[model samples]
Target chain A: MSALLELSSVTRRFGGLRAVSDVTLSVPQGEVLGLIGPNGAGKTTLVNVITGVHPASAGKVRFAGEDITRVRPYQAARRGIARTFQIVQPFPGMTVLENVAAAAMFAGGLSYGQRARDEALQHLRFVGLAEVANSNAAALTLAMRKRLEFAKGLAMRPKLLLLDEVNAGLNAAEVDQALELIRAIAARGVTVLIIEHLMKVVLSLCSRIAVLHHGELIAAGAPQAIIEDPRVIQAYLGKRYARAQAGAHG
Target chain B: MKRDASIALVLFALVALLPLSGEAYWMRLGTTMLMYGVLAMSWNFIGGMAGYPSFAVAAFFGLGAYAGAVAQKFGVPMGFAWVGAGLLALVFAALLGVALLRLRGHYFAIASLVVAEVLRELVNSMTGLTGGGMGLNLPIPAMASVDAQARFFFYVMLLLAAVTFTAMLITANSKLGFGLRCIQQNESAADMLGVDTTFYKVSAFMLSGVFVGVAGAVYASWVYYIEPPDVFDVLYSVKAIVMVLLGGAGSMFGPLVGAAAFLSLEELVWRNYLEVHTGVLGLMIVLLVLFLPKGLISLSQRLGRRGKLR
Candidate 1:
């Protein structure tokens, strides 16, 4: 399958600091790609570069064969790139259904009113948030807010969905439910690039894994091979831990 | 939306009967009230709906008053001049919003607040066109009598206020309004949801300016004279904001209710406490905002709830 998203030598700098440097990666159509890195590995910055929240300081980004290197955030969304913030961002004054319906109408190319609301309801059901559809989004609990993010992302009818630490604050059972929802989303042929710290989720749900260390792509391959890679282990668990793992495996 | 529209229609119909009283004093008060309603309703578009604290109302108002005055000076028809003022305000706001809306919150407020001062200076310097700080004079309309002129201007202001109210009702129910509410609540999320934030902000700003500009032109025509400090006074901006806050920000009837309440207070205070009216009015507004931050709409709703309990 052809790559749905291609980043060539993407670099993002905040003044003098290169937050994301020389990172080149791609996700093929319908692939569930896990992006794992240690803290300050620039994972979120890389996603920002992709979504044009912070346009790459250098390099090109191609989405579905079209160059979208300098598109605005709204344009990126309308072009079928949907993202959830690392910290959930909901329109607090709006109802949960209104939030998703806004996504459907604006980015999903559906008309506002009944059609958007109906589509939003379907996404809400998929995320198991149908019960609180009419409640103010601010009233939702953290887990529910995370699920609201998923419903919002789905309502955008995205070709590429970037889940930014959706499981970060979630508990074990909530994580399992999220994992199931993600698998269902992937089954529907949507490409996902999920940033996660959870090794279990990375190992089980992702067909392919990419590692970033100090703003560079350290490794990319099948999840099993990636977990055992010396550099990936070193980057995540330090050089001493990598040696310990190597000794145990040897 | 339907209920609000019908209520507004009946209210306007009753207000339209003011001329039947045959009292010039009442006519003057009613006209001034309607004009205030226009200013307040216009401010609601950007300040209340879009969550942008704009202090550029005086800039648009002064620009419109001058645009109409200057156009009339050059022999343009009265109706065409008012329309020209509205269009000029729309264009000016569109350009201004692109630059000003980039700044959010306090920064945006301060930036917009300077616009009126800058415009006042510009009008002050342009001696030949604007007659400088000496003030400009508008030609008296060729009406049969002074009473006829007063009645005509009163009806004109009434019409402008009604149009502004209708526009607000339409906007509050439209996709544009929904996007604005989203922008107000969470701008970044709205942007990621494919709302063109800049576009929406500029549209709201334009909506806030167009009607106020027309009303300004009407005021200039009604008064027959306008000076830079008189038309471009920063008080216009402050009063618009106060009126919205008084009634209820972002509510359908808030601006109108606030305008009526505010004007009545102004008239009453000015009558009884002419020496200290400004000080008293300022203190009263501070108290109103402090005690009823949600505005009179919430208070009425609270009262209605209590009645239901009874």
Candidate 2:
């Protein structure tokens, strides 16, 4: 399949620091690409660059063959790139249905009426949040809020959905449910680039995993190959563990 | 939504009967009440809906007053001049919003606060056009009797308030309103959700300015004079914010309720404590904020909940 999103040597800088630098990556159509990194390795920054929250200071971003390097956040949404914040961002006073309805109405291009509500309800139901659809989003538990984010992302009608540490702060069972939801979303053919710290979740869900170390792409391959890569291992587990693994392998 | 619209219509009709009471003092009070209603509701579009604490109401109001007064000096009919003033404020707000709205929260408020001062200076400098702070006079609307003139201006303000109310109702139910609510809640999230936050904010700012602009124009015409200090008084902006806060910021009836309550309090305090009315008004606002932080609408809502519980 053709690449749905292509980044060529993308770099984002803040003052004297480079948060994301010289990362060339392509997410092919319908692939759930895992973006794994250590703390401050710029996983979230890369996502921000893709979504035009912080447009790349250098290089290009192409979505579906159109260069969107300089598009604003709203334009990026309209162009079908939706992202879930690592910390779930919901309109606190708004009901869950209204929160999702905003996504359907704006990014999904649905009219602001019963149709938008109906669409929001469907996504809520899909995420098992239909029961709390009328409750204020701020009142939701963390697990429910994560599910709400999924519903919102889905309501955006995104061709490429970026999930930022979606499984963070969830228990094992909650992570499994979230994993199942991601699997179902992938089954529906939406390409996903998920930032994850959970190696198990990344290994099980991603067709290909890319590793970031200090704002650079260190490895990009199948999950199994990525796990065995010394560089990837070093990036995550430190040089000591990587050296031990190399010694054992030899 | 239909019920709210109808209730608003009924309330407006009841207010329209003020001139029939035959009390000139009450009629004048009613006119001022309606003008306050227009300002409060206009502020609600940005301050209440979009959650932008804009203190630029005086800027728009003063601009409109001047625009209308100047147009009248050049022989423009009063009705068209009022509309021209509204359009001018709308365009000014759109342009201002693009730049001013880039700052959020306290920064945005501070930025908006300076706009009226800037406009005041500009008007003061344009001595040839604005009469160099000497103030400008409008043609006295021709009528057979003084009572007829009072009724006419009162009705005009009442109509302007009604139009503003209708616009608020329409906005409250529109996509623009929903987007604005989203922006108010989480602006960055709203942006990611494709709400076109900048456009929504600018639109809200324009909505907040337009009716106030027209009201200012009407006020100028009603009073037959306009001066920088009188028209560009920062108190107008403060009063609009206070009224919206007093009413319940986002609800449809909140601003109107707040305006009525505030005007009544102002009138009562002025009559009884003429020497220290401003102090009394400040104390009352403090008490209201302490007790009814959500405004008067929440009082009804709380009571309804209590009644259901019983």
Candidate 3:
């Protein structure tokens, strides 16, 4: 499969410290790519750079064979790239359905009232939120809010979706449900780049996984192989500690 | 069953009967109430819907008044002068909105105030066109006797208020209004959802300014005078904002209710304790902000819920 998104030597600097340094990765079309990292490993920053929230200090981002390095967030969204924040953001005063409909009106040319409502309902149903269509988003539980965030992203009808910590704060059952939803979305031929902290979710969903430590990608491969690799293990611990833990555990 | 028609019917009844119940002084007060209602509703377009607090209404209102004054000075007909003032206000608002709507929250509010102050100072410094600090006086047109003038002004203000309120209702039900609400609730989320936030914000600001400017023009004509201090008074902007907040910032009838309540209080205070009216008005606003931040509309909503349970 062709690469849907390619990031080469992408670097983001906050003053003297680099948030994401010398990172290179590619996501294949119709595939789920998991990005796992420790806290402050630049996962969210990478997503921000790709979505044009923060300009990459040094790198090129090619999405579906087009250079979108300098595109604004709204422009990138219009170009079929959609993203959800790690902290789920919803229009608090609006009903869940109206929140989705606003996206449909902007992403598609569904300017008419009935058309926007219909398309919004379809997206909400797809995300299993059709039942709470009239409920104010402010009243939704955290899990439902995460689902609504997903629904909002889907409403944009993006060719590529970037999800940041969609499973954070979710119970095990909720996480399993989210994982299933991600799998289903990928099965529909939408390219997904997911940043997650749960190792089980990353292992189960990603066809390939990239490991980041201190703003650098230390390893990338099949999930099992990457998990067993020495460099990846060493990156997670100091070299001596890795040897000690491996010896003791083995 | 639509809320718009129900509200419209109530407004129509009130407008039709208000002329019959009062002396000339009370009718004059009625005209003032309608003017404030128009200004409040206009402020609602940007402040309530778009979640952008604009404090430059005095600038647009003053601009409209000045336009009318200039037209009248050039021997233009009274009717043409009013139209010219409104159009001029619209143009000025569009230009100003483009520049200031880019700012968010406190920045936008302060920018609007600065614009008003700048306009006031510029008008005060210009002696040739505006007659400078001395102000301009117009020869009262012979359209009506003194009593007739009061009645005509009341009706004119009523008609303008009706048009503005109707426009707001239509906007609240439209795509533009939905976009604005989204922007207000979560601007970045709205962008991800495909809303052009800047466009909607600027459009709302301009629409709000046009209505306010038209109200100022009518006010100047009704009072038969125009001056920099009176036309560009910062208190008018505060009154509009207070009216919107006291009624309910984001609801259709909130501003109207707020205006009525505010005007009644002002009248009582002026009549009973004229010397301390300003201090009392300030105290009332401070109290309202602290205790009823959601405004009278929310209070009524809570009451209706309790009534249902009982």
In the range B67-159, model 2's lDDT, one tens digit per residue, is 999999999999999999999999999999999999999999999999999989888889899886898989999999889989998999999
Candidate 1 TM-score on chain B: 0.98
**Residue A74, candidate 1: alpha-carbon lDDT:** 95
Candidate 1 lDDT by residue in tens digits, A1-250: 9999999999999999998888888889999999999999999999899998999999999999999999999999999999998899999989999999999988998865798999999999999999999999999999999999999999999999999999999999999999999999999999999999998898789999999988889899998688778788767956775666579789
Worst 10 residues of 2 chain B by lDDT: B301-310
Q: Residue-wise lDDT of candidate 2 within A1-250, one digit each (tens)?
A: 8999999999999997898889999999999999998999999999999999999999999999999999999999998999999999999999999999999999999987999999999999999999999999999999999999999999999999999999999999999999999999999999999999988899899999999888999999998788778787766956775566568778
lDDT of 1: 0.94
Off by over 4 Å in 3: A237-250
Candidate number that wins on DockQ, 1 or 3? 1
Candidate 3 local lDDT, B1-310, one digit each (tens): 2776697768767765777975897788888998999999999999999999889888889988888887888998877888788888788888888898878899999999888789889999998999989988876868658888888889888988888988898889888888889888978777766677778888888888887777877777777778899999998888899999989898988999899989998888888888999899879877986798889878888888988955
Native contacts kept (model 1): 0.82
Where is the poorest 10-residue window by lDDT in model 3 chain A? A236-245
Which segments of model 2 are wrong by more than 4 Å? A238-250
lDDT of 1 by residue, B1-310 (tens): 8899899999999999999999999999999999999999999999999999999999999999999999999999999999999999999999999999999999999999999999999999999999999999999999999999999999999999999999999998888999999999989989999999999999999999999999999999999999999999999999999999999999989999999999999999999999999999989998999999989888989888888954
Interface RMSD of each: 0.7, 0.5, 1.4
Q: What tier of docking accuracy does candidate 3 attain?
A: medium
